[model samples]
Each structure stands twice: as C-alpha cells, then as structure tokens.
Target chain A: MKLYALNMIQPVGEKPPPEALDKVMAELAEVRRDLESQEAWVFGRPLHGPEASTVVRLRDDEVIATDGPWTEGKEFIGGIIIIEVEDLDAALQVAARYTRVTGLPMEVRPFQGLI
Target chain B: MSVLVRVFGDVDVAEEAVQDAFAEAVRRWPADGAPPSPAGWIITTARNKAIDRLRREAAREGKQAQAVLVNVAEPVEEGVVRDERLRLMFTCCHPALALQARVALTLRLLGGLTTAEIARAFLVPEATMAQRLVRAKGKIRDAGIPYRVPEEADLPGRLTGVLAVIYLVFNQGYGGRDELAAEAIRLGRVLAELMADEPEVLGLLALMLLIESRKGARMRDGELILLADQDRALWDRGLVDEGQALVRRCLRRNRPGPYQIQAAINAVHGDAARAEETDWRQILQLYDQLMGVAPSPVAALNRAVAVAEVEGVEEALAVVDGLDLGHYYLFHAIRADLLRRLGRREAAAAAYDEAIGRTENEAELAFLRRRRVSVCG
Candidate 1:
C-alpha cells in the first residue's frame, strides 16, 4: 500500500540526540530492506522543510504574484516521504520504526493518488 | 450441582471456572474418546469448580453468604438449544462498554471468530485486536461493564449497538477465511429471531440474505464480477424474495434508520431484471438520505458512483477527484476504470499501479495487474 509518512517534527533547537537520529536512520534502512520484498515501490526521504514555494493569483485578465512561505508558524515541517508498501499493516510497521526514534512523533496515512 | 444447571451468580467466578474446566477438557478429551454430551459435562464440571472456589473464598474471606447462587435440578432433556451463547452476546454488547470494545468482544466471544478475523473486520492487526480484547475484558471487570441486558427503557438505544455487532458479524462472514460467511448468516438468522419486534433487525437479516445471495455470482470464471457486469440470471431469486418481503414489512413499520434505508436500496437492486434496469434514481435518493444520517466518506463515494452513472463519467470524476481515498483500493481501482473507459490510457495505467500498490487482497491486486497489462501493453 502507498502511504504518506507524516513526520510530525518539533523545533530543531531541541534537535534529536545523535544516537536517536542514528536509530531512526537504521530503522529506515531496515524497513526499506524488509518491505522491498513484499511491496511494489517505496518513496521517501527527510526534507529541508517546504521552502520551495510559488504563489500566484488570477484576476479577470491580470495575474497577481506573491513571495512566500505563507503560513506563519514556529516550527516548520522538517521532512516527509510518500512510500509504497504491502498494506496498512506494513505501513504501520514502518511507522513503528520511526516511533522508536524519540525526537518527534510519526503518523502514516495510506495515500489515494495524484489527479 | 446436578449434571447440569450450575449457575454462578457472578461472571468472574463463572468465567474462571469455565476456563479451568476448558483447560481440563483439552487435557482429557484427546486421550479419552469424546464424551457423548461434552458441553453438558463441561457446564456441570465448571459449576462444581465455581462451588469449590466459593467454598475456598468462604474459608479465606470468612464471610458466608450463600445468597446469590441457587443450584438447580438435573437437565436431562437431550437437545433444546440453550441460549447461553446468546446471553454471552448480550453481555458483550452491554452499553456500559465503549462501542468499539462491544463490537470487538461480540465478534470474539459470541461469533467465535479468531482475533485475526476480528482484526480484519476492523481493518487492524491481530496484535492490535488481541490488545483490544484484553482491554475490553479488563473494562468489563474493572469498570464493571454489566453481564446483563439493558433496562426496558434502555433497550432501544442499546439496540443500535447490537445492530452494529450484527453488521460486524456479516462483514466477517462476507470476507472470512472459513465458513465464517455462512456462520455470520446463521448468526443473523438467530438475531432476527431473538429481536423480532424490531423492524431494523428483520431488515438487517434481509440485507445479509440479499447480499450473500449474490456471492455465487460475484465471481465468474474465478474473476470477481463488478456489480454492473454480474449476470442478472445468476442472482438468487429466493434470497431476493425474502429480502423484498422483509423490506416491505420494514416499510410498513415506519421506523427508518441506516440499515433499513440501506436494505431498501438493496431491495431496489434485487428487484431489477437487468443492469440497465436498476433503479439508480431510488438508489441515489437513498444514498443522499444515508449521507445525511451516517455522513461517512464511504457513503459519499458510493453516491459519487451513482451520480456518475446518472450524469456522466466526467461528472463522476469530478465528484471523486478530490476525495481522500488514498488507502482505499476501490477508489483508485474505480478511478482507473473510469479513466480507461474515458480513453486516458497513461493516467489509467498510473492509477492502476496506484490501486495495485495499495491493495492487499491478492485476488484484487492480480486483477489490477492483468488490467494494467491489457490497457498499457
């Protein structure tokens, strides 16, 4: 099953310990290794937040543009990846792997598709 | 305690003894040939076990109140189907417990479904289901979720939860690995018999019959038949008639709810002679009504499909385009079918892959793969 990995991250001033981050990477590696056998495809990685933005607006004949990381917030989203696995059960197992690394909590929702 | 009729006043005591007796039976029954009346013997032995426990408690706790328990005379009448199992179901569905726990416990205890089956019904894992069962039993013991039926006034409110349990039973039957589908059907028959006064009860039984009646035709040449393509001639007339009769009776009662409404919708389809002849207008109207009552995304999805049929494929695509059915296999599969029919082959191929990626059912995944091959090759 394809799943959206919701990496709910906290502020990085309190960044996760080296050991914890190592555990997270190790777990990701193990999951990738294990699920490759049972599933069709896997898509994911940590990101540098959603800094790549293009904002625009339309009028009767004119267009409006704005520069932005529009939403004002304290902690921006640190990362996420869309993964393809065997089922919800397998996706959840991957989520459990992330849960073991305690910098922040993780959530996995099965994805529908792109239009 | 006689050879039967050992009734324990408290569920804790009764269950403890029953577990003990079951363990003993497991040890002995294999070595010795099976007893003629194994259940009766177990009941009797369990009762004695409970008496022994009380005696021990009387000695330890130093308080003797022989007030609650009343040992009964022998029950030698060979085979009147006792309702202890039904009573077990009532206890499981007691309103004091949370709705989720009630459904879980009912499937586990009364339906005799495996934890895996119960989990699949709830779309969770066996481990998760096991934890839920443990927590449910703990709530029953600690929070004192009752071991009896609700009050006369509470019966109607509680009936909804019982109905939900029946629905769970049907789903397990509908997708079970063994004779669960048949067993679930039988459970519905018994439930209808037990709750005859309730129109929805009859309606649910009719629904089960109607849906199950088509199982024979749901697959053709080992491929699952879409409802639109299923051969009308293969549909079971007997089940359709029973369902129609129940819906008519239900309509006369004038009590409307989700199950009754859904059953009515099914009744319309059951009455149809061909795919083209299906009363989509009535089915669409029913879906609109159900959306108001249940308000689930699933109901909305079905409505979209109905709307698609009534209006056009583009309209249907617009209806479901923004829906968050990421994990829902049918959503992607149906979308792929719509796209493929609309001659969007590349998009259709991608959607098929998406559907294949998300689906766990081997049969469905295989079907999608074959479709992908035919469409993209």
Candidate 2:
C-alpha cells in the first residue's frame, strides 16, 4: 500500500456563500463515506486559515520566529486528506472526486519511505 | 529490457541487467560460436544478473530487495513478453510526467536510444537530459506509478498520451534527424501491432509513414524545399503505397479520428503525380473533418492553405487573418505567402519578417529571408 497526501488548494480570502459551501460540504461527506467504504481513508481535516500559521527557523544555532504563512500567495493549502491506496492512479481517482466536488485544485504527494 | 522491468519493477535495474547481459554476449559469442537461441540466452543471463544484484542489496539493506527477489523466480512466458512491452510503453509515456520527459523516456526505454543520443537529438546538454531521465524515473518509483497497462476504462485517455509522445518524436525527426524519424516509425509499427484494432494507432502509423515518404525531398543543399516545389520522384513509392493501404484500412473501419483524417489528407496528396494535379478539394474536405473532430487554430491555418489552392489567395488570406495565432511561425509564413500571391509586396515583406523573427530553424530562416528579399525587389 502507498500513502498519498491530497492537499486541497484554495484562494486566500473570502469564504463561499453559506448555501454553496453547505452543498460542497455535503458532497465531500459522501466522498469521505466512499473512501471509508473502500477502506482507503486514513485521515483528513480542514486547517485554520493561513493567518493562524507561524514560521520558525534556525540559523547558525539561533532560532527565530516570524508571523503569517511561510510564503504569501493568492492560493494556499486549505486542507489535506491522507489515503492509503495501491498506487498513484487510485490516489488520483480519489483526488479527482474531491476536486470535482469542491471545484478546486488538489496536489497529491506520496509520503517517502511509507510504501 | 521490458521483460526485465516486469521482473524487477525497476527501470535502472532492468537497464543495468540488459547491458550486463549484452556485454557478456559480446565477450563470449565469438569464442563459443553463438547460442541456438540468442535472445533467450540473453534474457536468462540478465535475469541471473538481476538476481545477483538484488541478493547483494538484500544483504546490505534489509527487506525491499528481498520482496523484489520473490518475483524473480516466476517463469518468463513468451506471450507475457509482448504484453510487458506494452506495459512499459504505457509507464514510460504516463501523463503525470512532463511532455518532454515522456518523449525522452520513450526514446530511451522503448527505442533503445542512449541518453547522449537523445540529448543530441533534442539539442539539450547531455547532463541536462541525464538529470531529466533520472528525475522521471525517481518520480515513477517514488510515487508508485504502477508498471502496468492502464485499466480498460482509462485506456482511451491514457493511450492519447502515448500516441502524442510518438508523434512528437516523429515531428522532431521530421525537422532534420532521419534516425529519430525511423525510430518513431518503428515505435508506431510496434504500437499498431499491439493495438491492431485501434484505428487511431493505425492512423498514426500511416501518418508517419506518409510524411516520412517525402523526407528525401524536404531538404536540398541544407535549404527547406516547399512541397509544391519538391520532386515527386524523390518520394518513396513503397512507403506511399503502405501508408495509403493503412488509410484505406482506416476508411473501412469508418471511425475517423483526427490522426486518420490527417492520414487521409496525406494519402490524397500522395495520389497526385504532379504538384498542380493535387486534389486540393479533397484535402480541404479532410481538413474540414479534422477541424470538426479536433478544432485548433493550427488546423484552421492548414485548411486555409488548401483553401488558397481550391478557391483563391484572397479567400484564404481572409480565413488566415481571422485566426488568433500570433505566436505560431507557420501562421505568419503562410499569411506572407498569401500576401505575396496577391501582389501586396510591403505587407508580404512585413509578414515574412514576423515569420523570420518567430522561427528558430536555420533552413526555415533562410527560406523566409529569401522570400522576403523577393517581395522587397
């Protein structure tokens, strides 16, 4: 089995209207159920907005902290879903379902040394 | 190599094993008076070499090599070897890889071209091409891109990528490299044999063969030769016959795709004995069908060229001017030719400048410059 992290990318600001967001959430719930039925779901959760992030770096044995996201961009990673599947094609199928439901891009990356 | 890839599930390992087997053959074949089944002998030798390598790694590492070793014991079936090649083709041309990477990998893994040769063909530094191949292979291994043909449901979509890679290689060869063009035709034949019922595969093979038939006359003294000016006698009659036969076969199937339409158009061109005798009306109809099947500005531009022949330059120029293909060099070149035909010297010269500015090929630049000079005078 291979573990893939499907990172959902979304615009930085302005939430969708409640009605539209609710419909998407409902569709996503169904997708989650399908993944669970297939026994491929590992874990998944929405993240707080990028404003909630803090960056910490160590340079020459000295630690420094900075505020905001690591790099400012129009789009940011909004959530991540990790799934255990046989291969990339299977993981891509799962990601495709999520992207279709949400109408957003998903970057699928495999975890190293986890196959 | 494909069989070894199937056995080992690793491209690097398979490649190394095949090279080792060939090296052993070179050393022993002359002295031992050649084996009765040379191919089988090589496969057996490669398999043993792979097993030894895996065993050494298993001892050094811990578990991964041992897992691969377990599959090494399976007997190689003759029928499976053919399927293995198809599987390798699909894997090498997977859509997840970049387009250039897909072309390079197909040439390297399937065409048996060396990295240096591929690099030279592509005009990239050898190190750059080597890095590209290494990165692509790493992604395939790390991402667990399955080393198998896609499922039936995904076959059509996946097959397009494979065909596109083959066509890209063919076009690259069509520019100047005869060997690359031959390699692309060989790959096309292999694909046609494997997917015999697929009209698109047959169509692609026919397209390459038809184009390749005219290769001998495409250049003269390192200068580009327009099709209308090419000597028909220079075209290979055998390849023309073969390509036309395939197009006829496609017509019988009656499921016309973009490639089949393009091939049919070429077959029509091949029918004419002289340049003036070309069936422009038939070619225009094929281009119309091609546009309907797969519409693009490039196809629209090509159709306009045929329109120039069947109709007039004025009508063709109007069609060409309507399209938004500023970035494409051929669009400007064709427009310049139409303007030149209509006696619009200044405009023709300016359009030729646009074409010359956009193009990178030395022969194409020379042709455009010569055309521009004629219009100026």
Computed on C-alphas against the true complex, the DockQ of each candidate is: 0.01, 0.90
Residue-wise C-alpha lDDT for candidate 1, range B18-106, written one tens digit per residue: 67788889988999977888777777667677777777888788756642354642543333224555455666787556777887777
TM-score for each predicted model, relative to the true structure: 0.61, 0.95
Q: CAPRI band of model 2?
A: high
Candidate 2: residue pairs that collide: none
Question: Per-residue CA lDDT of candidate 2, range B1-377, in tens?
Answer: 88888777778998998999999999999999788767667777898888887778887887574546546455556666778889889999988899888999999999999999999999999999999999999999889888888998899999988999999999998878878999999999999999989999999999999999998888887779899999999999999999999999999999999999999999999999999999999999999999999999999999999999999999999999999999999999999999999999999999999999998898898889989999996
Q: Which candidate gets the maximum TM-score versus the true structure?
A: 2
Provide the TM-score of chain A alone for each candidate, in the order shown.
0.59, 0.94
